[model samples]
Each structure stands twice: as structure tokens, then as C-alpha cells.
Target chain A: MVKLRARCLLLGDAAVGKSALCHMFHSDGTLFQKNYSMTTGVGLLMKCVNVPETNDSVELYIIDSAGKETLVEACEKMWGQPSLLCLVFDLTSEQSFASCSHWMERVHAHCEGLHVPGVLVGNKSDLSARREVQGSVAQEWAESQGLEYHETSAKEMENCDAPLLGLARAFHSLYQERRETIQNLSPG
Target chain B: MIDSSLTSLGAKVVVATSSDENHPPENIIDGNTTTFWMSTGMFPQEFIICFAEPTMISAVTVDSFNVKHLKIEKNTSQNASNFAFVGEKELEHTDGHIQTNAVSLNGSSATHLRFIITSGYDHFVSVHRVSVQN
Candidate 1:
């Protein structure tokens, strides 16, 4: 069986359910924090995702950073060359959703111009009554950024695994593509 | 052009009998001779490399330190079991330098390759890299 490891960076504005989504997925949906605690530094959580229909697995090191503007600079230094990204946004907040490009630019700078495969996560889907970001708009923006879009509700543990699972599958496909290039090499 | 073409194109070491946090098993296929995976200290150490798919492998070259004997086996199944013997090599120890040896696999097709280290020149052995020719 093949096992791989990848660094997945979680990005978003504060109170966008970044930590909640991370913790919910890490705990396998058993725990969701009812009380809020501000994250000052980077919080790391790891979970192994078994790719469906394959013996392969990917161990994702999810780097959950503090989203406050004052804390973002300090958090930026801790995100080192992430191979995958989980860009989160609050579904009820247009400002948070608009800030996605800024967060992605920071990631682009930190990655030294390498294209990182990732997902744009619209969190807080359970709060449909307060939603401000339209699904079509989010999907269009995600397509423009070369990212797959996923809507999730960390509070209700709805579709929490889909984003990470998609990342694992994407990484697996990258390895497969690399192998195909080698297979094309004629024996010397 | 076929010199270590396997890892240069992209194949990864998925399993190792010994892995250091700093020197992971993945480093063995990273195409760097300076970085290596060291055994914790024992005989009968092994590691499995899984390819993207079943590949036609003709040969492989191993770069290492303190290794005495090496055995290779391959399997075409998706699972890493039921491997057949491909070949074996008795490596000569190089003092402080790396030992580079190449073994032919008789053009076998496999999805997984298993390398078994039955004995070593020292308690701890480090495999620097493995390059395959198909």
C-alpha cells in the first residue's frame, strides 16, 4: 500500500469556522466547540485519509492559523511551503468571502510561485437564513482561482470530510501523472 | 537517459522498516544522494515502494552506506503482498563513501517493489537513493 504525507494550510478571516472545521474533521465529527476561543498562534492537526477504492492513504498535516489581521502576520511565518490549501470563508459574511483573494496571494508568496492544489470552502452552511455569499458566485470565483468549491457546515458536521478527501485524491493523481511521464521514458 | 529514470519521473517509498523524523523513507526516492534514510539499528530491514501503476522495470541502482547484502522482490497486485524474487546483490562496503550498485530485474512488470536488507556492514545502515530503469 502507498502512504503519503502533505501539508494542508487552512486560510480564512477570523470567525469563519476555520478551527471549527479543522477540529470537527480531526475528531471525526464527534466534537464541535460551543464556546469560542481566539487562536493566537498556529494550531496543527493531523488526520489520515484513505482514498476510496485504493490501498493508498494520505496523512494530511492541517495547519490552522489565527485569522485576526493582527495575528495573520505572525501566522504567515509558520505556514511553510504548503502542498495543499483549504481556503475557508464565512457564508454569512461578504467581507470574509471577499478577502479570499488576499489570503490566496499570501499563500502564493509563501509557496514561492508554485501552484498548490486546494479547495475553497464556504463554511457555516447551517446558517442559511444569514447567508450573504451566493453559491454561484463562490463557484465562479473558485473556478477562476483553479480551486474546487465545497460548501460545509462545521457546526452540524455536514460535508466536513469532502474537502480534505478531495485534497487526498488530488495528491494521489499528481503522483500518478508523474509516474506516467516516467513510463513514457524508453529504456536506455 | 535511463539512468535512475524511475524516481526522476516520480515514484515514492511508501513503507520502510526504519524511518527517522528528520530522514524519512520518502527521501530515498527524492533523487538526492546527500539525504538518506537510516535504519534504527537491526538486521532484516525492509521497505516497499509503490508505483503509480504496474510498471515494466528492467533494472534498479541502489546508493547506500554500510550495506552488505540486498534482496529485491516485486508484485503486480494493488496490494503489497505476493512478491516474487527479482534478484539479489552482495554489496561491498565503502569506507565513509557511498556504495553504488545496480541490479537487473529481467524486465518484470510490478506495481510494488520490496527491498530487504538481511545484513549490513554496520548496526545502522543508510540508503541514499534508488533509481529504476524500465
Candidate 2:
């Protein structure tokens, strides 16, 4: 059994339901709240995900951070070196979706050249009537950025675990690739 | 390729140069990168990993932050002393991220593997995880 841990960064524009998504996933859909005061700093939550058909498990240390630009800069120091990224956006708001690139840029600048396994989360999926970003568009954009796509609704507690689970799986597989390289060392 | 890490095989970190309440040397073998063993604040920090039994290793991958130079030594003896130099590497510096590097061990059998950090990119360095391949 291989137990790996990854620091997962929860990022996006302000009021993108990042906190709600994090809480829903962390509490396993039992902690959804009607009101959440603005998050000013980084909130940490950890969850262990077991990969199917393997004894390997990954511990995801989710850093749910403030989405405002001002708060984001202050929280950056506390984020440490995030190995996984969960970029969130409000599906009903096109402006929030547009800011995904900016958030990705911040991560790139902070982590330098390290490859962060990531997923683009389109939250608030239940509000289909007011949706501003199409699924196909977001999927295409995520693919271009080397990130997987996930749609979720924290209010309804729908598909909230997909993004984090995807990240955990991705991190586990990344370690697997590295293990293969090490195992294929040819006794040199 | 091996599917599981040495953690499942019952490896332990027996000795370390420095230890903090939040960051202990044991974190190095936990197979979790988010939890790490951090150096208090200086150079020449080292640690010894003791395996459940003498195992043959071909390479080791280290995930660390701010570590500049590293030397790996191994020994098959019951004690931690009298370790032979297996290999050394100079790691690249990464900003706000762990520097992952895999070092070839040349298929040495050992009960204990000692990693000595001679220098660092910053004042304090942290070793997140170390995975060995046999």
C-alpha cells in the first residue's frame, strides 16, 4: 500500500463558491451552510482518498483560499508548495469563468516550472437556467491548460467530490510514473 | 515497476539531525508529501531510514524544498554506522514547490539508508518524502 499526500490549492475569483465546495467535499455533504462570511485567509482541510483496485491512497491537504486578489496575495505565503490544483468558477457567471486564466497564472508564477496536477471546477451547476459558461467551452479550455474538468453544485451537494478525487487520482498516477522510472533504473 | 512504496513494507526513520513538533523525521517515510520533515535552520542535516529487513534498492526519489546538495549512504550492518557512500546529487532549486529528484543507487542491499544534506538553497530545508525502488 502506498499512501501519498498532496497539497491541493483551491483557487478562483471571489464568490465562486470555493469555500462551499471545499466544505461540502470535506464534510462529505453534511456541512453545507446557508451563509459563509467572506474568507480572508487560507482554510485547510484534509481528506484521504483510496484508489480503486489498488491499496494506494492519497491524502489531499486542501487549502481553501480567499478568492479576492488582495486576500490571495496575503494567503500565498501560507499555501506552501501545492502539488495539486483545483481551480473553481461559478458556472452562472461568465466573468468568474474568465478569471480562471488569471488564477492559473498566479499558480504558475508562484510554483515556477513545477507541474501541478489540476482540475477546472465549474461550481453551482444546479443553476442551469442562469449558466453563462457552456460545458463544452469550459471543457475545451481545461483541456488546453492540461487540466481535467468537473461540474458540481455545493448547494445541492452534487458531484462535489469529483474535483478533489480527480486531483488525488492524478497525483497518485504521477507518483506511479515516477516509481516506474525508478524501478526501471536497470541496476545502474 | 513496484506498485507499492516502502512504507507498506514497514520502513522507519531511526535517526535525524533535527526535529520539530509539526515536522518530524518520520514524515519522510510516510509516503505523503504534504507532511514533511523540516530542518530547524542550518546546513548538514541528515537522517537514517531503517527498513524492516535488508532490501535491495536500485534508485530513490526524494521530494524536498530548498535542499541544494545531498549525499546518500547505505549499510547492511545491524547498526547505523559504517555506511558506504552510494551516490550524491546536487538538486535544483524550486520556488514554493518540492524539488523531486531520483538518484540511482546501483542495486545496493541495505538495512539502513542515510541521507546527508550538505547545503541548502535557503536557511531552512524540508524533506517531504522519499520513495525507494527495489
Candidate 3:
């Protein structure tokens, strides 16, 4: 079995449930904290995902960074060339959805124009009553940014693993593609 | 007395809780903001800077990233122990740029200055430079 490691950066506006999603994914839904202190910098969490129907696994080093504007600069310094991006936003808050563009721009700038595989996650799906961002609108935006879209409720522990699992699979595919390219270069 | 960079006057990082080969503790006093000392994903990380002699420090400026609560301590002893509380500051967050925070030491004389990063906004914090004025 091939084992790969990828740095996955989790970013969003403050109090948008980035930490909750990360914790739920890391602990396999066994743990969830209701009260959370605001993240000041980047919080590192790691989990290994087995790619379905393949003898490969990818260990995702999830960097859950602070989403506060004041801390973005400090958080960016530690981002250190992420292999995947998980741009999270609150489904109930239209402002959080609006900020996704700014977050994308910052990530792209940090990546130095490289194409970093990513997904746009609209969290807090359980709060459908207060939902301000429609799924279709978010999906269209995700398409425009070349990202897959997923909606999850970290509080309800629903579909919390799909986004990260998708990231692992995407990274594994990229690795496979690169390997194929190298093999094609062989003279034999 | 003339204000000078502590690193130019032989200030050395004697103790650090964590170290990285690419971003070493020495980078804190190297007088270069581009090169930095990065912590290895833990809380309450600290480093001690020892001066060649007991010098009166007027103020200190630290250029860092993601640091939250910073505590400063000092000592006049030749050894690297017995520290007295100097000061503390909660760094303000900045976006897209390193935080350049100036801390006043109130003209305290010390042979060793300890910088304890009690907390940070991120899991890992990077201190780019620490300059002292006399």
C-alpha cells in the first residue's frame, strides 16, 4: 500500500465552525466541543484516510487557521505550501459566504499562482432555519473558482468526513498522475 | 549610551523549547526579519537570549507572526537561571504582514532576557527578529 502525506489548510471567517469540523473529522465523530475559544493562530490536526477501492492512504495534516482578519497575516506565515484547501463558511451567515472570495484570493496569492486543489464547504447545515446562503448560489460560485462544493453540519456530525476524504483522494490522484508522467519519460 | 542591535553586541539564544533546522532559534536575534525562528506546534514555547554583559535595555522590538500572549523575563546572573518578571504584552493581530511590536523595558539592566510565548493565534509561531535599544 502506498502512503502519502498532504498538508490541508482549513480556512474561513471566525466562529464559522472550522475547528468543530476539524475536530469531528479527526476524532471520527466521537468528540465534539460545544464551547470553543477563538483560534488565535493555526491549529494542526492529522488524520489518515484510506482511498476507497485502492491500496493507498493519505495522511492529511489539517491546518485549522484563525479566520479573524487581524490574525490572517500571522496565520499565512505558517501555511507553508498547502497541498489542499478546505474553504469553509457558515450557511446561516451571508457575510461569511461573501468573505469566501477574499479568502480564496489570499490562498491563491500565498500559493504563488499554483493550482491548489480545494473544496468549498458550507457548514452549519443544521441551521437551515437561519440559512441565508442558498446551495445553488454557493455551488455556482464554487464552480467559478474551480472547487467542489459540500455542505456539512459539524455540530450535528453529519457529512463531516466527506470534504477531507475528497481532499485525500484528490491528492492521491495528483500523485498518480505525476508518477505516470515520470514513467512515460523512461527510455525503455 | 548608543542604541544598538543586541545581536551585534553578542547576544545569543542560549535556550529554546523547540528548534527547527530551517528556522533556528538563532534567527530571533539575527537582525533579519526575513529569516525567522519557528516553533514546533506546541504551547508555552520560550527562548532565552543572553547578552555578553549586563546592559541597560530601554525598549525591545519584536517582529513576529501569529504570537498572542508574550511574557518577558530577565536576570543579571552569569548563569541561565533565576529570572525576574520584566513585562508582558498581548500582540495585536495583523493581516498579510509580520507583527512589529515594540515593548518598553523601562530601562531594566539584565544579562539574560527570556521571551516566553505563552500563547499564539496559531499552532506554530514564528519570531522573525528581536531588536533591543539601550
Which one wins by DockQ: 1 or 2? Answer: 2
Q: Across residues A1-188, which tens digit of lDDT does each residue of candidate 3 receive?
A: 56666678999999999999988987898678899889998899989889889877777889999999999998899998667899999999999999999999888886645567888999999999999999999999999998889999988899888898788778777766543332233111
Residue-level lDDT tens digits of model 2 in B1-134: 34465577898899998755556788888877777776643347899999999999999999887788999999998998999999999999775456889999999899999999997764357787899988
Measured with C-alpha atoms, the lDDT of residue A51 in candidate 1 is 86
Worst lDDT window (10 residues) for model 3 chain A? A179-188
State what share of the real interface contacts each candidate retains: 0.00, 0.00, 0.00
After TM-score superposition, what is the CA distance of residue A136 in candidate 2 from its true location, in Å? 0.4
Mark the regions of model 3 whose C-alpha exceeds 4 Å error after superposition: A186-188, B1-134
lDDT of each: 0.83, 0.83, 0.83
Give per-candidate clash totals: 0, 0, 6
DockQ of each: 0.04, 0.07, 0.02
User: Candidate 2 on A81-174: residue-level lDDT in tens?
Assistant: 6678999999999999999999898898856466778999999999999999999999999999999999999999998878877887888777
Model 1: which docking level applies? Answer: incorrect
Q: Decide which is better by DockQ, 1 or 3.
A: 1
Give Cα distance to truth, residue A128, candidate 2, Å: 1.2
B1-134, model 1: which lDDT tens digit per residue? Answer: 35553566667777888655656888788877777776643357899999988888899889887678999999999888999999999999676467889999999898999999997664357787888877
Off by over 4 Å in 2: A186-188, B1-134
lDDT of 1 at A121: 96
